[model samples]
Target: MKINILIPVRALHDGKRRLSPALSATERRALTGWFFTRTVAVARSVLPASDIILVSAAPDLLAYGQEAGLHIVAEAHPGDLNTALRLGAAAARRKGADATLCLSCDLPFLERNDLEAMIATARPGAVTIAPDRSGIGTNAMLTAPIGAIPFLYGQNSFTAHSAAAKAAGLIQTTLRRRGFACDIDLPADLDSIGFMKNDRHIIAAE
Candidate 1:
């Protein structure tokens, strides 16, 4: 099946504000760049860059995505996360995608295998979700037929997505892997891992 990996990104300057308590503004921005770049790297390892789309309203991020040879979908300005993701899904559909995996960009510990597992979980009428460590947030999800259910991403989004998929009559699967569970949103999340960055990958050391 033709698949696309759509990653929604916020403006780097305003991306990791919740971590301000432990990281300076500059550090937070750098961290945001690091997280997004690493997430894309992992995706590239799973699929060709041509099939990966970076969805954002940020011009800077779009430029970066273009430089990385990834398809760029311009999200509506002042849009919410769900809206941007929906737009990305639509774009993927227009490109003839049979399934699209919506992935969050802050997954610091994410690996190529985590992405592979999510893709493997997808079926003709199935939705697979990888919940965050708290099991309240959706870190990664692959949906067959793109818009079978609304994009529900926010507080307690895992529950929202579960109900939506069930209502849509799609078989649901939840993947619980350490790589998918670890996203660097708060200071505590950042403190849980060690990051070593090089030209290619962000190696996370426990």
Candidate 2:
């Protein structure tokens, strides 16, 4: 099946507001760039046949996504992450993708193998989520049949996704992968991942 990955990014200035306390504005921008770069790299590595779509309101981010060899969907709406993702998913479906994976751009450690495993395990009328380090936040979600479930992302998103899946009568599965579990949101999270140095490549960034 052709899996299309949708990465929704808000403006660079407001991208990781939660992470601002841990990093300076410059550092946050760099971190955001690294995060987006790593996400695209992982997608490229994992699904060679799969297409990576980046939906963002930031012009720089769109350029970066293009540089990363990903399809860019410029967000007409500036601040709405959900809307951007929805548009991207719709575009993917229109492009004839068999499945769509909505992945958070902050997962620096995500591995190609884990994504492959998730794709292999995917089933019709099912939704899969990869919880964050706290096991409460959702870092990655896969919805078969494209728009099977409404993507509700935020704090406690894992539970919300599970609830949505149950309500929709879709089989729900949670896969705990180390790569997908670690996301950079706070200073402590950054330290915990030991990603303090500047790394251009995904493997080194992680």
Candidate 2 lDDT score at position 13: 66
Best candidate according to TM-score = 1
Q: lDDT score of model 1?
A: 0.86
Please, what are the lDDT tens digits per residue for candidate 1 over residues 52-89? 98999899999989999999998768488898888888
Model 2 steric clash total:
0
Model 1, C-alpha of 6: deviation from truth (Å): 0.7
**Which pairs, if any, clash in model 2?**
none
Query: Which residue ranges in model 2 land beyond 4 Å of their true spot?
Result: 48-50, 197-206
User: Going through the candidates in order, what is the number of backbone clashes in each?
Assistant: 0, 0
Tens digits of lDDT, candidate 2, 1-206: 77898888877667677877766676677777767777788888876523888898789888887877788898766856678888889889888887888888888767889888788778888899989979899888888878888878767888988999999999888889988998877778877977655645422332
